[model samples]
Target: MFTFLMMLLLFVPIGITVDLAEKVGKMLENDVPFGEIAFYYLDFTVYFANLLFPLFLFLSVIWFTSKLANNTEIVAFLSSGVSFSRFLRPYMIGASIVAGFALFLGMYLAPIASQGFNEFKFKYLKKNKSVQQTKDVYQQINDHDYIYVSNFIPKTKSGLNFTYEHFEGNELKYKIFADRISYVEKDSAYKLTTYLKRSFDNGIETVEKETQKTVQFPFELEDLTPVEYAAETKSYGELLDFIAAEKRRGSPNIGRYEVVKLKKWSLPVSIFILTIIAVAVSSIKRRGGMGVNLAFGIAIAMIYVFFDKVFGVMAEQSNFPAIVAVWFPNVIFGILAIYLLQNAKR
Candidate 1:
């Protein structure tokens, strides 16, 4: 725990400093207030902490165990008739504690921090790039109503080539079409341009057309336009409901959201996997002392991170199953941990 805290202290500030340096110009250009800037940094600290959590645990374990090996403590302990399995008990307990904390962060705290962090980023650093906009969206507002938009823009609360269909018992009751549809805040209603409404009743059709019209709809802009990183900013329960709703809406970002959802659980499991690997690799005494163990552990950590990012990208950018992308690193490292533990037993 002490080593973990030390690693956290060492790395978080460095991350904050590097980020501040890069974003300082943007903050100044946007004329952001001092308080908001400070709050953004705090959010960024949480974001980075959650991001580098596994690396932090991995390195801390390597450092602590390597020092013990360098000082001959590991040899002394083993020579005193403590089996390797017995020696691993305390490390497992420590890993459980860290894993619980990481789980809490992923499930709850990280979402709040992510919201603040991403909000500040898109608000200041990358203006006019709202995540709530998408192209060619189709959604079922209810069993009886459907809507589509060729392009939806949240900033203006408007859409192009908007179409709405009302159905009753597998029959189209009416359909509405508009060249443009927009929400009017003052009136709490929708304004449609080049509007046309067609109703069908017992094979008799009635058509109503207008250049412009004001009307009410059963849905709101928020229902149609979800933020791209909405998954990251939602609690576990909320994310599950959100994912279900998105699935109902035929959202194209299912893979990306699934990856985020799975990682919340997978990260805690990874803590145990990494801890075992660290102890196994560092428990053996070497002529080069702790240096060799530290180097080897760092390399493994980097490779783990590389695999995680590559697989995560594949899941986000393609139809690859998110479960595989999220769990593959843990499986590979779990195997490594087993192999190293067996060798250390000798």
Candidate 2:
């Protein structure tokens, strides 16, 4: 835990300083207030710390264990009638404490920081909100009602080629079409341009037309145009509720949300996996000393991060299951951890 805290203290400020330098020009151009800029960095620190959590734990374990090995402390402990498994008890206990803290950060604090970080970027750094908006959206608002838009601009709360349909027992009962639709957040209403509606009752049809109309719908602006970072903004409980709601609505972003949900648990579990690997890799005093152990630890950390990112991308882009994608790295590295531990024991 001391090592972990020291790593955080050392790395977080460096990351924040670099990030602030990169964004300072943009913030200055936007005339952002100093208070807001400070808050943004605070959120950034939380986000960066959570992101590099596993690496921090891995490095911490390697550093201390390598020092012990160099001092022949581990040899002394083992020579004093301590089994390798027994020697690992303290490391396991420390890993459990770190894992609990990581779980809390991932499930609760990280989401809030992610939301704030993305919000600040979108609001200040990005001039074009269209980059964050998804196009050709189709959503089922309810069991009988469906809506579609050819193009949506989330910043403007507007869309083009909007169509809404209602069905009764697989029969289209009503349909509404508009050349353009814009949401009025203050009024909780929508303005439709060149609006037309058709209703059918017992094979009889009734039609209505309007050049422009303001109407209330059963959905909000977010329902019409969801930001790509929607899942990142929600806490664990909120994410569960949001995913369930999206599933009922047949949202296309379910895969992404599931990835986020699974990652929350997987990250914490990885702390233990990485801790074991670090201890096994660095517990032996090598001719090259601590440098060799650190190099090996860094390589393993890179591989772990690469696997995580590749699988996460696959899950988001393909039909890969999010749970499998999130846990695959842990499973692979878990096997490595066991192998290393056995070798270290021998």
Q: Which portions of model 1 miss their true places by more than 4 Å?
A: none
* Candidate 2 lowest-lDDT run of ten: 127-136
Tell how far residue 45 is off in model 2, in angstroms.
1.4
Q: For candidate 1, what is the TM-score? A: 0.95
**12-96 per-residue lDDT for model 2 (tens digits):** 9899889888988999999999988888888998887887888999999999999999999999999999999999999999999
Clashes of each: 0, 0
In order of appearance, the predictions have TM-scores of: 0.95, 0.96
- The true-versus-predicted C-alpha distance at residue 109 of model 2, in Å, is 1.3
